[model samples]
Target: MLNKDTLLRIGCFLREQTGKVAVYGLKLNAQAVYWHFPKSIACFLDRDINSGFFCGLPIRRIEDLPRNNIHAIVIAASLSAESHIYARICDFCDSHGIVIYSLYSGKLKAECLGKAFPAEENQESELRKAIASHDIVSFDIFDTLLMRKVLFPTDVFDIVEKRLREHGIDIPGFKNYRIQAERGDKRHKGLAGIYLTLAEMLGWTDSQAALVMREELAAERQVLVPRPGMGEILSYAHDIGKYVLLVSDMYLQPEFLQEVLAENQLTAYDELYVSDDRGTGKGEQLFELVRKEHPAETYLHIGDNAIMDGWSARVHGFDSWLVPSALQILKTTEAANILSFAENFNDRLLIGLFANRTFGNPFAVREKLVSVKSLPQFASFFLAPLAAQYVLWLLQRAKIHHFEGVLFAARDGWLFNRLYQAAAEIMKLPNVPPGMYFYGSRKLCISAALQEEKALEWLKGHLVGQTHHFLRECFGFLPGDGHIPPAWGEDTDLIWNEVVDKKESIFARSAVIKDGYERYVARLGLKREGRYAFADLCSQGTTQCALTHSVLPNLYGLFFARYMSGSSVTMGRVETFLPQADWHMLANNALEFIFSSPEPSAASVDENGNIIFEEEDRSDKELKLLDEAQEAIEKFCHEFFSLCESDGFISPAIGHFLLSMYQQPIFAGAGKVFDGMDINDNLMGVRVDCLLTNEK
Candidate 1:
């Protein structure tokens, strides 16, 4: 809220007070004044002004302020607004030859600030001098200079047990003690106590037990790996002229600790403290030793165990830090107490860093890494897809083959035969050709041959006695004479030339046939395919016999075509006519004959000439006739418009047809017309059109 003028005035005032000054806006009022100051005035602003009120100065209004030679306006706003106000003040003071002093809590002392201070150059020089000074600083090794519990208890116990057994020191109860020791249960007693207990149980002499214990202890100690970054911190401290020391309540000898540190590439400390060497646990005595060793320098000790290291340091008047393992620290009930203690005690700070078993260092779990907790989370992860691709590549490298295909029934009975017959008819259709057809149940019969005849024969044999005999039998018609239309004779060879063989290309061909059929039906302007080549095309195999009967007139053309071809496609021979033969009788008789029915007229024909009263009337006669005609019209228009829309296929006559079809409610009215026709015909034209045009 501070304006440019107000900030400039505040900066000028600060410059008068101190040759080089920094202004801090502690609240909203302070920020308002700080922003209007000149660039020469360094202004620091608090982020959250509403939380509290400002009581420092009365430089609120920018207009009434005088422009003086103020050097800085340190906007000491609340922590929240510090960055924002600092940026604004710095930018406003940029061109005025002003140096803005931005106070950062992360780097600056929270409790100390003064108007007159050493120059920036002097501060930098002092910092360098501090770094160059050599001083011995003692640090507790466990949970301080080194990590705690590097190896699992089981791992350490295993090594100890193996060594003890090799030394011929056997005891039945040793295993239980090892288990308890590995778990770090102080209540279970220390390893030294366990070795004595085992020696007593095994009736061994003190000298023999001690000898075996030493060997097992050596083996166990070898497994205690140091924490990551501990050595680095120690080395860094040592490089800065700080003498390093390890103080722990460990039972290992000083020599062993030194060897371990040297192996881990750590600098040798000035002194080392182990319970065995110190003759006591960590306490005031340890601090007394450090004080005696380094009398002239300030010393700080850091460790994980609060009672042993922290309390001792406090009692001895030494600066201390508590750095605990992430897991153990989380489990501790005294975390709040430790944090409160750190807050109240200026010299101590409790630092928490995460460490896992495999990765010993405290590395941040990035937001991106943490996000991969669920399947969808993994899927959306930026690198997950790439990882999956890599895995797939690996699988390929391993030469892992897999099966990919569709499953279908392959029975050679009624339904199977019908399926085959349908497939065969589809293949036999002009411009239709054979391609891959899969058939089987859970246990499938696979064939990759291109010969339609061979495929059909294989299907028939494989499905003949199968549970899905009916389905297999139906599919069997794909290869044989039964599948072929009557127009194509048994001896007539399949013409495989010039037909596009790709499955997709074949499907496209079917779409073209379907389009042509629909357009031809539409041109006739009939509500149904009552009398067109389309109806016949719709009624080919036995599966479509009932369908053909529904659209009687359309099937007439197909029937005629088949009959004329003399291809021996079977239909019931109808030699006898009814006593009273008429248009209705002839139609009913033809349907009955085709279906192999003992009697026609099992259902009645309605006034609209539709067979509307029989459950057995699956034939789409009326609906097919009407819908086919409507669809044909729709196709003609769609094609005509498409052609017109294209660059070279424009025809006014076609356009007129398209316009006429578009205007006439053929699509909307077709539904009504279909409802009036037979149930079989209800969707025949639309379905056929969809099939032909590949609309579906």
Candidate 2:
């Protein structure tokens, strides 16, 4: 294990050397060093090398390879075997005049490189300069001006395949077959020609082939989004009175491409040149067509392909600006390490969605390696998937159980209810139980349940360490009310005898609270005898117990997680979607706060059926941030539900792993999302300030 200082010194030394450098080991330590200095390090050398590669670098044997122009060899080994590895490599280093450094040593032979994943060059300014100098500005459509929400263009086939199977068209190996269909005799075939090949392979009629082609196009419409700031670049070219042309080596027709452009508000181009319309592509002929039709004093072409857009365009007498694609930029950063864990189809889909959003802005690397611009982007990347998974589980569970309706508990349930309704509609699933936001909280529900025998026990456990204001809030009393003595306002243990004395008074006040809630529940219009279920965050079934015992009997509870210590009467009616082991490992406060509503917690209800909310402790900026985050989560859920089928659902393990990455300090700028945020629990008299600040 190399310490940070040691790694820093070694990286600086390796980067400063002009000649080639090689690591001695071929394991994780070597991979880590390669990531830190990918361009600086040449290759890896080992005694047992068999012509393998690590991190795209070739592996070589020291005895078989020539040592000309070799600079240094760093022993990327554990501390226990560092001395032995150093001794084995020192003789070769001395003969070759190569300096050998230990992974554990703090001193090294050279200077430090500044950032982990620095930009290869300043290209954005150069691109703007080229656009300004040229009369005609040409752009590549795919991965340049426009980007797909998925990682690869062909991932669209996976989505189409999932949709096909959902509609009872389960063809095995459909995605691979679709890929091969396009890769047939001609490489630049149009949509119709590719589907004709698919029809021949699958023994389908022309109509069936056309249906499948339309499915692919629909999938494209769902997954396509504008690359961040590229639209502005195109508009800038147009504003300067330059003729802008969009070119792409794609099978989609020019008309459909225009519609896609218009849909994303990218309508500043003079013309679109598609490969399918001309049977030629940007490799050679598309640029020739672009030049022949639209002559200009000086032409500039901007694209992502190095060979097709740069060299090929230069051959056609046009200057080119080659920008890196989203995938190209993401592969250089720690995102590669994060994405290595994606082993399944669903996992890759999620990674693709995240890649589309996080890397869409090409200049994100200028500020930080992995840039989360705001709280909303943080929510979309880390929080939305977990929230969607919970909703997906609920959708399946509702169908299996045949529940009459779902009652989402207030505050936390506000987001869940909206997500549930949206997902249900998008999936087009039949017989889905109606989900509604139920305005009830622990404070309000526990007040209604004080008459029950176990309510006293619950109160003792939750309110013992709380202040008197919290006690009043729990029992439906307002601050500054003359209901209790002033000395009781301090942080004091709840004396059972003293509570007994106030029991009559508390019950008398709580009666109006119970009546107000009863009227509110009646207004929901759900049948009293229906098999209704309650949806909530982490709980021990207190809300469920109160609702079932007081207002609505025979109510079932569906929780993200449950943490009861002993057996209870509501055990059979309750089911925890998240397992205990997974629940404790997560930051439950963050989850609750991220998915929570901006509205204050429900404190109590008056006799006239008006709900009294807790004092709003959150600042207006905090409220605005929550609203933005909720919108981002909703957008992600909408996209996920629209594209992904219920089959091969996102696993809980993957969801947990993505969330842990956000909560940890692995990504730069993640802590900025929660920098000054606080979570207040008025009923418990607890406030978590600057939560999840990445203090380690």
Each prediction's TM-score against the native? 0.31, 0.73
RMSD (Å) of each candidate, 1 decimal: 30.6, 12.8
TM-score of the candidate numbered 2?
0.73
In TM-score terms, candidate 1 sits at 0.31
Residues 369-475 of candidate 2: C-alpha lDDT, one tens digit per residue: 66566878888887787787788888888877899899999888889999999999998988899999988887788677676436565666544455355456566
Give the lDDT of residue 277 in candidate 1: 68
Clashes of each: 86, 0
Query: Best candidate, TM-score-wise?
Result: 2
Strongest candidate by lDDT: 2
Error of 2 at 109 (Å): 39
Tell me the whole-model lDDT of each prediction, alpha carbons only.
0.35, 0.73
